[model samples]
Target chain A: MQVRFWGTRGSLPVAPKAGTIADKVADALVAANGRSFADKAAALAFVEDDLDFATGRSYGGATSCVEVDMGEGPFIVCDLGSGVRELGLDTLRRCAQEGRPKEWHIFLSHLHWDHIMGFPFFVPAFMDGAKIIIHAGHPDAEQALRRQQEEISFPVPFDWLKADIEFRTLETGREYEIGEVTVSVILQHHSHDSYGYRFRDRDGKVAIYSTDSEHKIDQMHDENDFAQFFGHADLVVCDTMYSLADSVSMKEDWGHSSNIVAVDLCHEAKARRLALFHHEPTYSDADIQRMHEETIRYEELTRDTDALEVLCAYDGLCVEL
Target chain B: MASTLEWQVDKRDGGTVVAASGRVDESTATEFAEVLGEHAETAGARLVVDLGGIEYMSSRGLRALTLAHRRGEEAGTKIALARPNETMREILSISRYDMVFPVADTIEEALAS
Candidate 1:
C-alpha cells in the first residue's frame, strides 16, 4: 500500500509560498537578539511587516484531503476536503494514463465542511459511468450529501453529477474487504461524529488514519481511544493541528491534537511510524518544520520503550506501506 | 457502599435491566462503575443498560461503560445497551465502545438476545 498526502493544512488552505516570510521572520528574530537596540527595533518592524503579508496569504483556502493507493486494489481516498479536487483530477489523469476505469472508495471522517468541501469539485464524479463509493457513519448519509447540493449552498445540485455514486453507512469496528485489503472503521472523539480507519493488506501491513481528535491533558494519563484504535499498526496518520503550548493554552477542546500527542499515541500503540497531518493553516513551512523538530525532541525524551519514526506531512508527500 | 448515582435494577426473564438516569459526567462516573460492578456479581445473568434517559456522557462516562464491559467478560455475562439516543450512539461509535458492547435499537430486542 502507498499513502500520499495531497493536503495537510486543517480548517483552511494555506498559501503555497509562505515559507519565505517565515524565513525572513526567523532571520529578523535571530538578528534582533544579537544586535543593538536600533537594529533590534528595525528588525522587529520588518518582522511585523512580513507577518502581515504572510497572514493575508495563509487565510484564504480550504481544508484537508489525502489519498491512499492499495496495490491493485481499491483507490481509497480519505476526507474530501478542498484537497480532493486536486486528487480527483490526479486520479483521472492516473486512470487515463493507465488505461483503466475510474473507480474509487471514499472514506469520510465526518460531514464537517472542512472535511467534505471538495466533494462538489471532484471532477471524475462529473464524468459519466465513473463509480464512487462513499462510506460514512451518519445514518442519513445521503441526506448530508443532498444538503450540500441545496441551491442555496452550491450553484449546481448533486443531481447534476453524472457519476454512479453509492453511499454506505459504516458501523464502527466492522471489518470489510475491498479487493485484497481489509478495512476497519473505529470511532474518534471530535466536535461531530467522526471515524478512524485501519487498513490491512494480505501481507499483514497496516495503516491507521485518524484526524480531528482531541487529546486532553487527562487523556495522556488514561488509556486513550487512539491507543486502542491504532494498536500495532505499521503507520499512523494522525491529527497534529496544534503545538503543545498552543493546544494547551488556546485550542483546548477544539477537537484537534498536538504533535506531541500524536507522537505519544504512536508510541503507545507501538506503531512503526507516525505521519503528522492536519497542520494548522497558520503554520508556515518553517513553523511546521520547527514543530516537527520539537516533536522529535519530545518523542526522543519521552519514548523510552518504542522505536517509532515520525514524519511531517506536506501536500504531495507520499509514503509506501 | 456502592457509590450512589440513582439506578433501578430490574430482574427480567434472562437478563437484568439496569436503568440509570442523570448526566454521567466525571464526578458521577465512579458511581456508575460501582453500580455495574455490583450488578455484575448479583445478577448472574445477562445485563442491559437502558440509556434512553441519559442526557449526557463524557469520556469518564465511557470509562465506566468500559469497566462494565470488562467486568461482564470476567463474569461470563453478556452485556448490552438498550435505546441509546443519537448523541449517545455517536459517542459510542466514535469511541469504538459500540463494538465492545451490543447495542440494540429497542428494549425488546435487547431482552430477547
Candidate 2:
C-alpha cells in the first residue's frame, strides 16, 4: 500500500506571500553567489543536493487530505479539505486518462468547515456514474455535508450532484472492509470529536491516519493499551499542531497535540514510523523543521536502544509499505 | 487520602475560593466543572480558584477552567486563580490561563482585585 499526502497544513490553508517567495529566490541566488551554472543538470543537482530544506522545499499550504493506494482496489482518500479540490481534479484527470470508472471512498474526521469545504468543488460529484462513499463517525455527517451545498451558500444543491453518494457512520473500534483493505476507527478528543482510522491491506501492512486529535500524556491510553490499538503499524499519521510548551500551556484544551505528545505516544506504541501532521498554520516551514529537529533530539534522549522513525508530513509526501 | 481530585469552597474576603487538590484529570474534570457551576449559579460569585494544592493538572483540567471562566464571564461572576503552586503556575503559564485570569499573590489581593 502507498500513502500519499495531498495536504498537511492545519486550521486553514495558506500560501507563501509574495515577499516570502521573493526572499526565497533572493536567498537561492545568494547561495549561487554569481557562480555560473555548469549546465541545466548541474543547476538542478545544486538545487536538489545543496539547497536548504526550508528555503528550497515548501511544506505546502493545503489543508488535510491524503490518499492511500491499495493495488487493484478503489480510490481511498481521507478528508475533504481544500486540498481535496486538487485530489478530486487529479483523480478525475487520471480516471479520464486511464479510462477507469471513478469509485472513490472518502473518510472525514469531522464536519468542520475546513474538513468539508471541498466537497462542493469535487468535480466528480457533478459527473454521472461517479461513486462516492463518505465514511465518518458523525451521525449527522450527511446532513452537515448537504447543508454546505444548500442554495444559500453554494450554487449547486446536494441532491443535484450526479454521483451516487453514500454515507457510512463508522462504529468505534469496529473493523471494516472497504474494497481490499480493512479499517478500524477510534474516537479522538477534539471540539467536534474526530475519528482516527487504522487501515490494513490484505498483505497485512498497516497505516494509521489520525489528525485534529488532542493527546495528553496523562490523559492518553496506557502504553500497553496504546500498543495494542496501534499494534505495530508501519505508519501513524498524527497531529503535532503546536510546540510542547504551547500545547501544554496557552493552547491546552484547544484540541491539538504537540510534537512532544506525538513522539512520546508513537514511541510508546512502538509504531515503525510516525508522521508529524496537521501542522499549525502559523508555523513556517523553518519552524516545523526546527520542531522536527527538536522532536528527534527529544526522542533520541528519551528512547532506549531501539529508535522510532519520525518524519514531518508534507503535501505530496508519499510512503509505500 | 482520596484518590480523586477534591474541590472545597471557602468563603473568603469579598469572594468564594474553590481550592482544588489531587489530580485534576479526565476522571475529575466533570465533577470539577459541576462544582464551579454551583458557584457560578449565584448572582455575584467573585470566585478565585486556589490551585496551590493541585498535584497534577492536564488539558482536561484546563478545559474545565476555561469553560468555568467563560461561563463566569457571561454571568458577570469573575473567576480567577490565586496562589497557584509551582507546577500549577507552570501549567497556567503554558496554557496561558494566567493571561485570562487575574493571578494574584494572595486570596486577599485576588478578592480585592
Candidate 3:
C-alpha cells in the first residue's frame, strides 16, 4: 500500500508570506558562500543535502486530503480539504494517461468547512464522466456539502456539478469492504464529533487515518478503544495540532490532539510508524520541525519495546508499506 | 500478576500526601487517579502528590493528574505535585502539565506550595 499526503494542514490552508520566502533565500545564499555550481544538478544536490528541510522546503499549507493507493482501480481518498484541488488535477492527468474511468472513494472524517472546502474546486466534480462515492460517518454529510455551495456562499451550486456523486453513511460497529481493503470507523470526540478510519489491505498492512479527534485523559475506555482501533497498524496518520499543554488547557476540548498523545497512542497500539499530521495552521515550518524532533525524543524516552518510527507528514509525502 | 502501581497515603501537616511509585500507564493510571482523588475529597484539603519514585509515566498518567487537580479545585483543595524523577519530570514537561500543576523538586517544597 502506498499512502500519499496531498494536504496536511489543519483548520485552514495557508501560504508562506513573501518575507518568509526571502529569509529562506537569504539563508540559502549565505550557506552557499560564493560557491558557484557548474550545473543544475550540483545546486540541486546542495539544496537537497546541505540545506535543512525548513530552510529548503516547506511543510505546505493545504488542508486535510490524503490518498491511499493499493494498486486498485478506484482511487481511495480521505477528506476533501483544499489540498484536494491538487489531487484532483493529478487524478485527471493519471486518468488521461491510463485511459481509466474517473472513479473515487472519498471517506470524510467530518463535515467541518476545512475538510469539505476543496469539493467545490475539485476538477473531478466538474467532469461529466466522473463517479464519486462519498462515504461519511455523519448522515447529514450531503446536506452540509450542498449548503456550502449555496448561491450566497459559492457561485456554483452543488446541483451544477457534473459528476455522478453519492453519499453513504457508515456506522461505527461494522466493517466495510471496498475492493481489496477492509475498513472500520470509530466515533471521536469533537464539536459535532468526527470519525477515524482504519484500513487493512490484502497483505495485512494497516493504515489508520485519525484526525480531528481528542483523547481525554479521564476517558480510559475511549483511549483503550482508540488503541485497539490503531492496533498493530503499519502507519497511523494522526492529528498533532498543538502542544500537550495547549491541547489540554487553552485548547482543551477543541477536538485536536497533541504530539505527546499521538506518540503515546501509537506506542500503545504497537503501530510500526506514526505520521504526525494536521499541521497547526499558524505554525511555521521550523515550529513543526521542532515538534517533530521533540516527539521523536519523547518516544525514545518512553519506549519499553520496539521503537515506533515517527515522521512528520508534509504535503506531497508518500509512504509505501 | 500484581498491580504495577504502588502508593502510600499519609496525613501530614494539615494536609494529605500521596506518594506514588512504579509505572503509571494505561494499566495503572485509573488506580493512581483514584488514590489522588480519594485524598483530595475534603473541602480546603491541602494535597501534595509525590511522583519522585515513578519509573515511567504516560500521557494517561498526566491526564489522571489533570483530572485530579480539577477535582481538587472544585473542592477548594490546594494540590501540588512533588519530586518527579527524571522520567516523570520530562513527561510532565513535554505534556506541559508542569505549567498547569504546581511542581516542586522536593516534598518539603510541595508542602509549602
Candidate 4:
C-alpha cells in the first residue's frame, strides 16, 4: 500500500502570509550571495539541495486528507478535509485519462468542520458514474455532510449531487472486510469524539490512520488496548496538534495530542513508523520543523532501538510500504 | 482503566500544599474545581500546588487551575505550582501559565518564593 497526504494542517487551514514568503525569498537570495548560477537547473538544485527544509519547504496549508492506495482497487481515503478537492480533481483526471469509472471509499475520523468541509467542494461528487462510499463511526455523519450543503451555507444542495453516494456506519473495534482490505476502528477522545482506523490489505501489510484522537498518558498505559491495536503497524498517522505544554496546560480537553505523546504511544506500540499529523494552523513551517526535530530528538533519547522512524505528515508527502 | 484524580493536602507553616495525581481531563475538572475551591477559601495566606504526582492534565484542567489562581489572587493569597514534571512544564510554558503562577522545584521552595 502507498499512502499520500493531501493535507496535514489541523483545526483550521492556513498558509504562510505574503511577508513570510517574502522572507524566504530574501533568505534564499542572501544564501546565493554574489554567486551566479548557469541555468534554472543550477538554481533549482540550490533550493532543493542547499537550502534547509525549514526555509525552503512548507508542510502545505490544506486541512487533513489522506489517500491509501490499496493496489488495483477502489481508492481508500481518510478524512475529507479541504485537501479532498485535490484528490477529487486528480481522480477525475485519472478517469478521463484511463477511460474508465472510479470508486471512492472515504473513512471519516469525525464530523468536525475541517473533516467534513471538503465533501461539498469535491467536484466528482456531482459527476455521473462516481461511486462514493462514506464510512464513519458517527451515526450522524450523513446529516452533518448534508447540513453543510444546505442553501444557507452552500450554493448546491446535497440532493443535487449526481454521484451514487452511500453512508456506512462502522462498528468500532469490529473488523469489516471491504473488497480486498479489512478495517478495524477504535473510538478515540475528542470534543464530539473521533475514531481511529486500522487497515490491513490483502498482502497482510498494515497501515493505521489514527487522526484527531487525543491520547492521555495518565490513562492509556503501555499494555492497554490502544498499544495492542497499534502494535507492529507499518505506519500510524497521529494527531500532534499541540506542544506537550499546550496539550496539557491550556489546550487540555481540546481534542488534540502533542508530538511527545505520539512518539511515546508509537514507541510503546512498537510501530515501524509514526507520522505526526493534524498540525496546528498557527504554527509556521519553521515551528513545525522545530517540532519535528524535537520529536526526532525525543525518540532518539527515549527509544531503545532505531527500528521506529518518526516523520511529519506534510501536504503531498507519499510513503510506500 | 478508569481515569481518576487524587488530591492530598498538607498545610505547612508557610502555605497550604496540595499534591495532585492521575489526570485532570474533561470529566474530572468539575470535581477538581469543587475540591480546589473548598481548600482555596481558607488559603488566604498562601497555597502551593505540587504537580509532580500529576500524570496528565488537559485544557479543562487548565481552566480549573486558572480559575483557582484567579480566586487566590482575589483572596490576597499567593499561588505557586511546585515540582512540575517535564510534561507539565511544557504545558505551562506553551500556555504561558508559568508567567501567571510561580513554579518551583518543591513546596518549600514555592512557599519561600
Candidate 5:
C-alpha cells in the first residue's frame, strides 16, 4: 500500500507570500554562484540537489486530505480538505485514461471546515458515474456536508451535485473491510470529538491516519490506548500542530498536539515510521522544518528499542509500505 | 549513561523544594510525577523543582512536570522549575514547556520568586 499526502496543513490553507518566494529565489541564486544552467532540467537538478527543501520547494498549504492507494480498488482517501481539489483533478485524468467508474471512499476525521471545504470544488462530485461514500464516526456527517453547501454559504447547493453520494457511520472499535484493508477507529479528544483510523492491509502492512487529536498531559490512559492503536504500524500520520508548551498550556483543550507528544506516542507504539502531519497553519516552512529536525532529535534521545524513522509530510509526498 | 532518577523533598521557609537528579525518562516519569504531586499537597505557597542535576529528560518527564504544574495550581502552590542543563533547557524551549512553568536559573531564585 502507498500513502500520499495531498494536504498536510491544519486549520486553513495558505500560500507563501510574494516576499517569501523572492527570498527563496534569492537564496537559490546565491547558492548557484552565478552559474548558468543549460536547460530547465539542469536548473531543476541544481535545485533538487544543492538547494535545501525550504529554499527550493515548499511545504504546501493544502489542508488534511491524504490518499491511501492500494493499486487497484475504489479510491480511498482521508478527509476532503483543500488538498482534495488536486486529488479530484488527478482522479479525473486517471479515470479518463483508464475508462473506469469513479468511486471514492472518504474517511473523515471530523466535519470541520478545513476537513470538508474541498468537497464543494471536487470535480468528481459533479460528474456522472461517480460514487462517493463518506465514512465518519459522526452520524451527522451528511448534514454537515450539506450545511456547508447551503445557498447562503456556497453558490452551489449540495443537491445539484450529479454523483451518487452516501454516508457511512463508522462505529469506533469495530473493524470494517474497505477494499483490501481492515480499518478501525478510536475516539479522539477534540471539540466535538474526532476519530483516528488504523488501516491494516491484507499483507499486514499498517498505516494510521490520526489528525486533529490532542494527547493531554493528564491523559496517560488515552496515550497508552492510542499507542496500542498505533502499535507496530508501518507509517503513522499524526497531528504535530503545536509546540509542547503551547499544547499543554495555552492550547490544552483547543484540540491539537505537538511533535514531542507525537514522538513519544509513536515510540511507545514501536511504530516503524512517524510522518509528522497537520502542519500548523501559522508556521512558515522553516518553522516546520525546524520542528521536524527537533522531533528527530527527540526520538533519538528517547530511543528505547528499534529506531523509528521520522519524516515530515509535505504536499505530493508518497510513501510506499 | 542513563541513571536512575532520585528526588528529595525539603520544606524550605518560603517554599517546598524538590531536588531531582539523574534521568527522568519513561521509566522514572510516573514516580517523578507522583513524588511532585505528593509533595505539592504539603507545600505551603510555592513549590520549586530543582532540575540542576538532571542528566536527561524526555517528553514523559515534561508530562510529569506539566501534571505537577496543574496540581500545584489547584492546591494554590505556585510551581517553578530551576536550573535545567543546557541540553534539557533546549528541550524545554523546543517543546515550549519553558512557558508552561516558571523556569529559573537557580533554586534560590525559584524559591524567592
Candidate 6:
C-alpha cells in the first residue's frame, strides 16, 4: 500500500515557495555527498535558480486530501477537505490516461466544515458513470452532505451531481471489509463525535489514521486506548495540531491533540512509524522542521526503544508499506 | 447485580439539598426512586441536586431524575440541576432533560431557583 499526503496543513492552506522543493532535493543530494565545498556551492546555485523559476506561485493547489492505494481496483481516500479538489483532478487525469473508470471509497472522520468543505468541488462527482461510496460514523452524515449542496449555500442542488454515490453509516466496534482490507472504527473524543479508523491488509500490514482527537492528560501517557486502536500498526498518521503548551493552556477541550501527545500515543502503541499530521496553518516549513527536531529529542528522552521513527508530514509526501 | 442508589441530603438556603454521586444504573434506579420519594416527603421544601460527582449515567439515571422531578412537582417543590460537566450537559441536551428540570450554571443559581 502507498499513502500520499496531498495536503497536511490544518484549518487552512500554506503555499510553498517555488524553489523550496528544489532546494530540499539539492540539500539531500549534497548531504549524501559528504558536504564538499563544490557540492554545497552547486546546491546553493540550484536553490537560487529554482526560487527564480517559482516566482509566479507554484504551490498549494488544494487543501487536506490524502490518497491511499492498497493495490485494489478502488482507491481509498480519507477526508474531503479542500485538498479533495486536487485529488479529484488527479483521479480524472489517471482515468483519462489509463482509460479506466475511477472508483473511490471515501472515509469521512466527521462532518466538520474543514473535513467536508472539498466535497462539492470534487470533479468526479459531476462526471458521468463515476461511483463513490462514502463511509461516515454519524447517522445524519448523508443529510449533512446534502445540506452543504442546498440552494442556500451552493448554486447546484445535491441531485445535480451525475455520479452514483452511496452513503453508509458505520457502527463502532464493527469491522467492515473492502476487498482485501478490513477497516475498524473507534469512537474518538471530540466536541462533536468523530471516529478513528484502523485499516489492515490481508498480510496483517496495518495503518491507523486517528486524527481530530483530544486526549486527556493521563491518556497521553497511558497505552490503553492506543493499544486498542493502533497496537503494533506499521504506520500511524496522527493529529499533531497544537504544541503541548497550547493544548494545556488555551486550547483545552478543543478536540485536537498536541505533537507530544501524538508521539506518546505512537510510542505506547508500538507503532513502527509515526507521520505527524494536521499541521497548524500558522506553522511555516522551518517551524515544522523545528517541531520535528523537538519531537525526536522528546522521544529519545522518554522512550528507550528504537522502534519509533517520527516524521513531519508535508503536502505531497508519500509512504509505501 | 441490581442497581443501588444512595442520596446524601443536607440543608441549604432553607431547602433540601441532595448530593447524588456514583453511577446511576439499572440496579440503583429503583433505590434512587425510593430515596427521592422519601426526601420529598420529609423536606416539603424546594430541592437542589448537586450532581457534580456523578461519573456515569444511563437512561435509567434519566428516568430516576424524571421521577424525582415529578415527585417535587406533586409536593410543590422545585428541583434544579447544578454544575454539570460537558458530558452530563450533552446527555441532558440530547435527552431533552434540560427542559424538564431547571439547569443552573452554578450551585448558587440552582439553590436560588
Alpha-carbon local distance difference test for all models? 0.74, 0.79, 0.89, 0.81, 0.89, 0.72
Against the true structure, candidate 4 has what lDDT?
A: 0.81
TM-score of chain B of each: 0.88, 0.86, 0.90, 0.90, 0.91, 0.85
For model 2 the local lDDT of residue A161 reads 95
Over A19-89, each residue of candidate 6 has an lDDT whose tens digit, in order, gives 77676566555544654437767756655554332221123434556776675567688888888888888
Looking at candidate 2 chain A, the ten consecutive residues that score lowest on lDDT are A217-226
Per-residue accuracy of model 2 over A30-71 as CA lDDT, tens digit each: 998897888989987878888876777888989999998875
lDDT (10s digit) by residue, model 1, range A108-132 = 8888888888899999889898999
True contacts kept of each: 0.00, 0.00, 0.68, 0.06, 0.59, 0.00
| TM-score leader | 3
Candidate 5: docking tier: medium
lDDT (tens digit, per residue) of candidate 4 on A1-321: 988999899989898889999998888889888778999999889989888877777889999999987656677899999999999998778677865358889999999999989999898899888899999999999999999999999999999999999999999757999856899999898888899999898888888898888765344432257777898889999988987656655676788887766776677678999999999898998888988887776666556555679989999999998
Comparing 1 and 2 by TM-score, which wins? Answer: 2
Error of 5 at A38 (Å): 2.1
Task: Score every model by TM-score.
Answer: 0.64, 0.74, 0.95, 0.78, 0.94, 0.65
Provide per-model DockQ scores: 0.02, 0.05, 0.66, 0.10, 0.60, 0.02
Distance (Å) between predicted and true CA of A230, model 4?
Answer: 1.2
| RMSD, candidate 3, Å | 1.8
Q: Write the per-residue lDDT of candidate 4 for residues B69-93, one digit (tens) a residue.
A: 6677777777888998887776666
Residue-level lDDT of model 3, residues A202-228, one tens digit each, is 899999999999887557668878989
User: Interface RMSD of the predictions, in order shown?
Assistant: 13.3, 6.6, 1.4, 7.2, 1.6, 17.3
Model 5 C-alpha lDDT per residue in residues A125-220, reported as the tens digit of each score: 998779999999999999999999999999999999999999999998789998768999999989888999999888999999999999877876
Strongest candidate by DockQ: 3
Whichever of 2 and 5 has more DockQ, that candidate is 5
After superposition, the stretches of candidate 1 with alpha carbons farther than 4 Å from their true spots are A16-62, A217-224, B1-113
